[model samples]
Target: MSELSRWEDLFREGNLKELSLGAMKVTREHFGNSVFLRGLLEYSNYCSCNCFYCGIRRDNGRVERYRLDDDMIYAAVDSGFIRGLRTFVLQGGEDPEFGTDRMCRVVREIKRRTGDAAAVTLSCGILSRESYAALKDAGADRYLLRFETADTELHSYLRDGVSLERRLKALEDLRSLGFQTGSGFMVGLPGEDDELILRNIRLARKLELDMIGIGPFIPHPATPLRDAPQVPLEKTLLATALLRLFCPRAHIPATTAAGSLEPDGREKMLSCGANVLMPNISPVEVKPHYLLYPGKICLDEDGLHCIGCLGGRVAAVGRKLSFDRADGLICKRRDRVEAGT
Candidate 1:
């Protein structure tokens, strides 16, 4: 059977044990038992776009909007680095006030502060090609822009008429600018189905993404999707395992959304195929305000406490938490080939 047909059969059979084992095998072949860690800094909750599913959407008047200045962001980075985090992911909403110039300065300062010892990844939403280039020049090592769904109509509806074509173009721009590009999607968005999930995996392969993050669709009470039916956590895990089989070398995170659904959700993901964990390093005081979905885990914990907690969790899964920059295997191979090594 063709690989596509094999995947379809695995999904249709509803045999998660077999699927998980296959994916785990692939993951071990490439990554062994080392789970990479990225420190996530949610620097802002002020998004311009009104995505139908998001808690911090601009239309949600109940959200207490906040943005961290350069000093505040730097302090957070310093704290994460001191905790032995070698990668810091600066994530925020699409706030126009924190535009290209300010972001470039922030990236440059991070590089300087860490003396180029750590990897910096930015997950701020869509920007112009020039802006991506400027950030790259400022020493940003990676970028993550999740399309959220593969169906164009669903993506447009969820994102207030923003085209999937535009999102794909932005991803292409990021790759062309030589950033270690990452993109991901929610597993159980309203209107999504098995076919769309397959398309999401195919699209990730086509993009040759360095990192792929998959999480369950958790509803926020303030958003339009509050009334939408919740998808089973099993569906999200199936998607995670399939993504691992398809993109074995790409970094996949055991997302906190998974953990929100169940006490052992993240651990379950790690056992299957996930090889990365992004512990929230954002200040505890502001974490409650940056809620993308309700019931997010670890909101009350400080950065140092989160590190220790995550370390224990990693050990429970029989995987060691790695503090290296942990660039994707594909990126590392390409760099070596380019240098004629």
Candidate 2:
């Protein structure tokens, strides 16, 4: 169990209670009681690529696509500020209509308005170095583009035109620009094996990234892999804990998809190794509109309405949810200050 040569060793070789306890202890040692809040705003749902696992694919007829304009994007940021959102995650499909210029303007405007009140993290799909530089110059503090997988062939089959090489290049580009880069995977992906999962973890650690966004594989009804099996909730929990043990300092999230699979999923993930939680701040009416996968958690409420519920929900797990380090990326060790006493 201690060796961790295989991922299953995290579960098969020992009792889950102790594993959970170990994860919590590490979580405390690294993050203490603080949890970061990242205001997630899906600005657009118009995707160029037809991923088999997403509902926003260009080929999905049932999905009603929409793109929020600059004003609407600004309004979403303002809304998060009112509700105590200190970090803003501007995520959306790789819609060309927004363009690089438009995207930069939106980012710069947000940074101008928010000042140091929050950090702007970009999850807009892949792009050229020029585009990345432009966004970085516009003052994006972090970037999150889930690698999805380290296997090139499997990733290509799922997402058209998104090569594993390009994904890594993007991560590299972000790092070169001095931005905190985050990459992730979808556990239980079709045709994925244990080796790939282990490799993905190894790659994330090797990349020396600032954040990791591992989540379960949830299928979309309109996508090609509609009938695909969803990732097991327990497996997701184990991954979270394993991530803690592997990279104790990395920013890890108990993904919402995990919570969607089960009531205690987020709590279990936090107890295992998760240090961050991204509550949906998108509008309630449009929540179902930005469907990346089926049965997505936190879809019923907007950012304003969900804070109270999420605060209570985190309390159930014997944790606290706040805007401080809710995204779990930025580093500020508190132990040093207390040691001075």
The lDDT for every candidate, in the order shown, is 0.90, 0.78
| lDDT agreement of model 1 with the native | 0.90
lDDT of 1 by residue, 44-102 (tens): 99999999999999999999989988899999899888889899999999999899999
Task: Give the worst 10-residue stretch by lDDT in candidate 1.
Answer: 4-13
lDDT of 1 at 333: 77
Q: Write the per-residue lDDT of candidate 2 for residues 1-341, one digit (tens) a residue.
A: 34555444655454566667777787788788656667789888998888878889989989888877788888888988877788888899989997889989998999888875688899987888889899888888789988888888988778876688888888888777767778888888888766677777777777876789988888887888888887677766766776676777888877888887887787778777787778777767778899888887767777678778777867877788767734333323322343673
RMSD (Å) of each candidate, 1 decimal? 1.2, 3.8
User: Highest lDDT among the candidates is held by which one?
Assistant: 1
Count of backbone collisions in candidate 2: 5
The number of residue pairs in model 1 that clash at the backbone is 0
Distance from true position, residue 98, model 1, in Å? 0.6
Clashing pairs in 1: none
Candidate whose TM-score is highest: 1
